[model samples]
Target: MKNTFEELKIAKSILKSLDDIGFKVPTPIQQKAIPKINSGGNLVGIAQTGTGKTAAYLLPLLTRLQKPEGNDPRVVILVPTRELAIQVGEDIAELTTYSELRHAAVFGGIGWTKHAELVEPGIDIIVATPGRLWDLYQEGVLRLKKVKHLVIDEADRMLDMGFMPQLKQLQEIIPARRQNLLFSATFSPAIEKLAEEFLDFYDKLEVAPSATTVSQVTQTAYKVPNYRTKLNLIRYLLEDEEKFTRVVIFVKTKEHAEGVFKVIQRKAEGEKRILHSNKAQNTRINAIQAFKSGDVRILITTDVSARGMDVSMVSHVINFDLPRDYDDYVHRIGRTARAGNKGDAITLIDPADEWHWKNILKLIRKDIELLPLPEEVEVLETEFGENQDQLREIDRQRKIDDPTFQGAFHQKKRKGSNKRSFDDKFSRSKERQKRKKRRKL
Candidate 1:
């Protein structure tokens, strides 16, 4: 008997391309998704990174594209980041190499005229970031009416970046009859609401256990005293006599990303690079490619690369700063242990971060043994109250001199009293009006 995708009855040419790409058997996600996709149902594929999800949706869409019915772009894929856009575009290109169907990538980092030129002949598929695509749509350079398929990849990230408004606007502009496919590494309840808003009567496809970390990765954590101590621990970890050829360290903020990059550059006698939203687009792309090519030993990046990164040989992933969200923790660890290779992930957790640490353990449903701090370094109970003393002093000064806080607090109380007083007066006025009416009667 034929497989699920084959049973979906894809076109011969598309099947030929799939076979050429060495895709005989579909992954669990593809297995579950292809059949439903062939049935023309809106699909929400919720699986972790590296689950062959790109092919799951691409193959089904390509099957329909090979039969060519209308002109303007037929498939539209929206991604959160430029790197993801490029990755999706490459995947589409690989699947359609033998076919005449064209694919165009639209993102902010490159010149729009180049993208405009590519879009001139129109395309079978357009993979883009929400902001750039929204700009083009508003400028009248792109048309969504001819779009037959709409795919929103990384719905949670897109929502986190505040693209819901743009997505709703795009939905209003695009034809209502298009097939919708929403894919993400994790499907939280918030993502579910987005799927409902975007897709009608969609079939949900989940490839792995929700909110679960990759089994192939070894997860470990260390408790540090403070941010500076965490940095020292990262330096110590990277300098281990047993070194990894390629390592990606995830930081929580843009400043921290640059700071880590500097520290690695100064301390390591090896190559390193920095990637964050603050960097130019080309710089970010080149950094990713360089790291993938093993040209860069260490890549310091913010959460931008924690999701949708496809590098297979990443040997180690270090979380210099533990992410507050458990889902983010899962995505951060996913960067490593990909393509059937074993990888290691280590995190530095400060006492202040225990709240997030607790949430993470709850999400993973496992006990994460906390590694002892380096003996040379000192460890102490993180002072939650001491850290806020500076802010408290500032508030005190404001109350003594500026009077802004005290005035605001008193003004709020006065406003509340006035509101209550107005309500009483209004009630008395209404009662007087009722009595006057009764007297007249």
Candidate 2:
């Protein structure tokens, strides 16, 4: 087993770039993957986020990237989101700093005219999202016949976001002879099925068990009463500026992302930013860049949007809301505890999140430590409106899982309401007849 980057037979220029970036040792993923990737074969890498999975493939590919020949890309990397495309493009630039490799990243939000100009001359490598890539290909701006390498990064995430159709389309369009590499955090049945359909015969590389989180992260969950109380807890925790210096708070929805940011804006005492689908592309990129440069202490984001961000040395990852999708918990926590650095993951769970919380425990195959609420963190009473909203969502989820499941928020009807229920059909008819008789008199 090669233990260091030097033992992996990387090119001098790439090695020089890595050394300049202070990458002394190869991570577990890199150690297990680089050798095979350096040689020629289709590969499937099963590893979580922050496992240096990007470098595992990028290094070897960068070494293989020769000078551009024609008006076409030699390699195409498909990511799940635009944020990831930008981050991967940045990584490629850093990795090829000492080399002469040319790359471009094309995603939505920016005008296609700009990307059209970018790929007009030619590109060595292209990192893009499925929709944007398809759009460019349809516009005759992207040529894949010259593509010698095809990489589907964050395969699980791509499939979750319904990119399988686009992937199948690209698979049919790109040259049939290129090497394929699919990287994923977990190999669930669905992901495995995707691998079987999408990838040719390939070597498998796994650094850890599926759904395994970073060992360096200390995991803890706080049982809060409601969303307002979760904010109170966040306020209490952020008071320790030294401990919570660099944080990524993960929420489930755009509304929650905005809500959390607003509260922390007035209450917390540090620079903060929010990233969500509703935000403009430049805005999201700027927020992430600011957080990466240490200009901001906190970044609140949704799971899908944060998948591509690779900020190092994150002090902590706080789950402002437990993910309904259990696998996201792993991705969220993986943001911290990176590169053998110890960090913490704090999860706030409300009554509505109990079902999702249990699923998370089952996914990780263990129970997390429960942290008692601090004295300063006052648990606020859940307001009636908020409680009903939560109950409605919970009931909706339960019905999907179990059709017979009856929940607390079951629909009820008032007698005087205009809309009549099946049980009130006769009463409504009688009321109408009484009104008609009075009118006739």
Candidate 3:
């Protein structure tokens, strides 16, 4: 295994930057992916988030590009979210600080003028979200004819967010003879198909089993009775300021995000921010900056919006609502236990969420130990919360799929038959009709 960044034969300038950042020993993904990427061959890296996959591709690419040569970006990194684009841009900027490399990060949610200004001058590398990149390309502000290297970060996420069309459009834009690299925490079938189309005979490398959480994170679940109890638990846990100093709470939807934010805002003091799709871009950016600067102690966000968060020192990651997509569980916990730091992932599982929690366990293919709530946590009722919301949604869907299927919730139960009275009445009516037909015959 390649133990040190220096052992990778990177330039002294880049090595000094890595030293400054305390990135000495290579993580599993970096160790295997670095050398192969340096060889200029197509590669697909399968690893979890916080495993240093970004540096695995970036370090090698940086070493290869000695200096900025032309106006068009020679290297391009496409991410699904604006937040990830910013994070990759920051990573590249830090690494290239010791050397002479100009990089630009471009994405939507900002004015077109800002992105045009960044691309007007030559850029060695460009990190961007796909939509904005395509937009700039259409506007004649961006070009890929000179792109020598192309990297797609979070390939599975791009598919989840429905970026395949933009990616396909990019297929027609980029130079055919470029070095390609795709990295994902897990490889779903969609990612597989995309990789096949994007790469030309790439090497497949797996640092760990697919969908596995990092070993450093101590993951555990709590059997909370309901949403109010979850709120109480959050208050109780954050009460220990020393242990839960830097925390990120993950919810499922913007509505739920708002609800959780309101409760936590009322119960807790100190700097806390909420992130979702609806908030202004500046608001989201400021929230993350504050969280990273340690100014914000609590950051409540939706999984879709939080994908770009690369915070390493988060003390705890609490799942306010389990993701409907089980794969997201890996990414949620990944926000903590980063950069060789030990952290905790506490998931509050309600009765309805128990089924999803089981799928998460099965998907990760391991047993995350369950911890009994502190003898002090308040037990709550199941009258409201995401569980109720989910039930209501399922009923709505059932109505669409089968009009006659009254949902488990909508039909009242019969006293003796233990069946829905509506169904029982329908059955008796059919029986009476059959008896009347026999008597007439």
Task: Report lDDT (CA) for all predictions.
Answer: 0.79, 0.89, 0.88
Candidate 2 lDDT tens digits, 1-441: 998777898888989998899999999999989888878888999999988999999988887875556779999999999989999999999988888878999898887889988888888999999988988999998888899899999998998899989999988999999898999999899888888886769888889989988888899999998989999899889989989999999998999988888888978878999888888888989999999899999999998889788888899999998887788888899999887788999999887788788888888887799989999988789999988888888898799899988888767676668866777888888899999999999
Model 1 alpha-carbon drift over 4 Å, by segment: 1-24, 67-71, 241-243, 374-441
**What's the TM-score of each model vs. the native?**
0.82, 0.90, 0.89
Q: Candidate 2, TM-score vs. the true structure?
A: 0.90
Q: Order of candidates by lDDT, top first?
A: 2, 3, 1
Per-residue lDDT tens digits of candidate 3, residues 1-441?
A: 778888887878899999899888988888899999988899999999999999999999999998879889999999999899999999988998889899999999988779989998888899999989888898998888999999999998999999998999997999999999999999888778888999969999999989999999999888887778888888888878888989999988888788777877867777889999999988998899899999999999998789889998999999988888888999999999999999999999876677678778889988988888897887866775666786876676567668888886786866676655898889999999999999999
TM-score winner: 2
Q: Candidate 3 regions off by >4 Å? A: 384-441
lDDT of 1: 0.79
The window of 10 residues in a row where model 3 has the poorest summed lDDT is 411-420
